[model samples]
Target: MTFLEKLKPHLISDDILIQEVVLHALHDYPNVPEEWTNELLKEAFRNKDKQSSIFIYVENQTFNEESVKILSENIPLMDPSERHLAVNLVQRIEPELALKYKNQLQAYIPKSTWALYELLLHGTEEEVYSEYGQILNDLERAGSDQHHLYITAKKLAACLVKKGWVTETEIDLILEEEIKGRWFSFNGILNIYMIGLLKLEKYIPLLVRLLERDEDSLLEELSATLISFQSDQVIKEVAPYLRKENSIIYAASIVENMKTDFAVQVLREAYTSARELDQQDILFEALCHQFSEKALPEINKHMELDYSSGLVDIEQTAYSYFSILGIKHRELALWRQVALERELDFRQKGNDLPSAPVRNEIRVGRNDPCPCGSGKKYKKCCGK
Candidate 1:
């Protein structure tokens, strides 16, 4: 047998080290036939080991039409884990085909998972919370680990909460349960998703607690939700967490996504405090993604540092931002004109930083019919 064939049995090995060895060995045989690869993938699926040898195999190759069809047809027959991989592969290759078979796929997977994904994709906020409110409840009851479906469900829930479909009570319930269950562990993806999705001002205290955890786990997800606030107050709310010495890099990433003057200010503070060149470089790249004139002073500061130190990456980053702003070296006069206008705009809006407005209302009694027109009591519907 050839060297490639020698490693085939390792694909079904429960040992992760052996599985990894086999996967790496497969890469050395790039000229392996597609038909042979597909057959091996089928066998890998049938004899999936703890390391998910099939998932690793699938990741190594992009599927063509025939292979895509083969995977799609098998998804409904696969177990939850294999089905997850198949769905992700199909979605990566042909998203329309994934949706085309949504109903059939949903039949095999949990309804909550499909309902949440559908809500994110096509449903209105009112319809999602009302039509699929039960689905969220089912997920809540599933806790943070219901055979990996929780991760998919919670990610969809996070998107919904950001879009304002979830209720305050639901948010509180999720927080209380997750905290009690110690779902704050770094490996608890669903726990972090629920926390990140709980965007209410009242929950800021809870988020702060999680942010300060030694693990600094889930910072990215939390940052994305915080950016959804899109207000200066959110910068203040997140500032304390960013103050941690270890959190500077993540703070830069979060503020970069925010793209508001408030966000720029927060990033500036983090950049100033960041001691490592690598962290500063990350912040620099993030700023390039959302360039504005308010960023010029810090950009100039870094440019000078890079000039004195004979570094080029930071200078390149600044020029990239300039290029994005339509400023060219030949347009020095225009650059000055634009920069002054931006400075003026900044000064005018400096004291007028907006805060995320919260709306409080008199909630209905538990016995009342849900206002969502779901014909269910408040306790059994949106209020839950």
Candidate 2:
């Protein structure tokens, strides 16, 4: 078992030192199990030390009086970053409770944050829009960081557009700023997400032009935007990016989710023409994602060539990519999964190193709903 597995039982221990250590270790494990949710949240409030990762621990959880009490009582004990997160977390889950902390939290955060949260919770569209305007004035006066306003002011702006409150011209301007200001939110992914949400196909050229950008912060979002458009023009724009190290994963993902045989043909062609191992590794992975009779021979050929040449690092790279995919359980056929495992075994039996575990991590499983909000099974979309 890993250090986390060994220490996980102590996560809610009465002893603070052990719990804090375990809590810190929890950051390494992304999807904290549902059972640990309450205790971590309690510690998130109770711990005097920083627990900045409190957001991940309480991801799908909503607010309750119990959690609120714990958090409100420990607000003063939290570090600056922790306080920022606490305010955002509370505002998101239970904005009324966040408003209750406004007097206390204002000493630390961007101005008018709690007010915006309250408007979000209780105010009508008109009230929130009016408050949004007031926030712009406050931001200007303070010379506030756009990054600090994302969950508050930026969220309000997103809501305005989502509710059809913004004009198309206004949305175009917002899209430009959101995409350009990578640090303002979830990178260009969230920006492009607005476009996808609006089903704004005319802006594919805008996205295509921005491909010169290195906005790989969230491949799932970028991939979703491309999948939403699914144009030959998009596919054409993304094809060359398949060879680039930074962009290849989602470029390949875009091809995979397009779900056209032409997309498969593109991958096959990309693989055949590719020279570098890094380039081929990604192309080959996307081709394997297709999982056809054709892919099996190609997969085997790679195994035979690489393992026979004693390229264990190649296997290591593959394991790392699977981790990137965050694939809890691959949704392939029994034979297909075995084919993958057997290929790893092919490397292990010939080499001295133990086989890399085919990661059945506590991550998004292939059949799980896509986190990208695409409403398809992950395997059919981004995880494909």
Best by TM-score: 2
Candidate 1, residue 77: Cα displacement in angstroms equals: 25
The per-residue C-alpha lDDT of model 1 at residue 343 equals 36
- What are the per-residue Cα lDDT tens digits for candidate 1 across 1-384? 333344444444453333433343343223345665566567655664421334434443545555655665766666673354455445433223445666544444456555455566777877655644554456557643343443444445555666766566765666677677644532243444554445455555465456654432255445545555555766676665555656654455455556466776777776677676655665555555445666677666665553222111343344445653555655444444544454355435533533311101112333233334333334445556
User: Which portions of model 1 show Cα errors greater than 4 Å?
Assistant: 1-151, 155-167, 177-199, 273-279, 306-316, 329-384
lDDT of 1 at 268: 72
lDDT for model 1 comes to 0.49
lDDT digits (tens) for residues 1-384 of candidate 2 = 333354455666653323323343343233355456656776656543324434433543555555565656676676663355565455554456556656654554455665566566667789878876766565545532333443455566666656676666865676678666744333234556667667777877666555545533334455657677756777777888776666665577677555455777778777777787766766665654443334444545564553322212234323322332333324223333443564455445535423322121112334333434333445555666
lDDT minimum window of 10 residues, candidate 1: 356-365
**Residue pairs with backbone overlap in model 1:** none
Clashes of each: 0, 0
**Which residue pairs come into collision in candidate 2?**
none
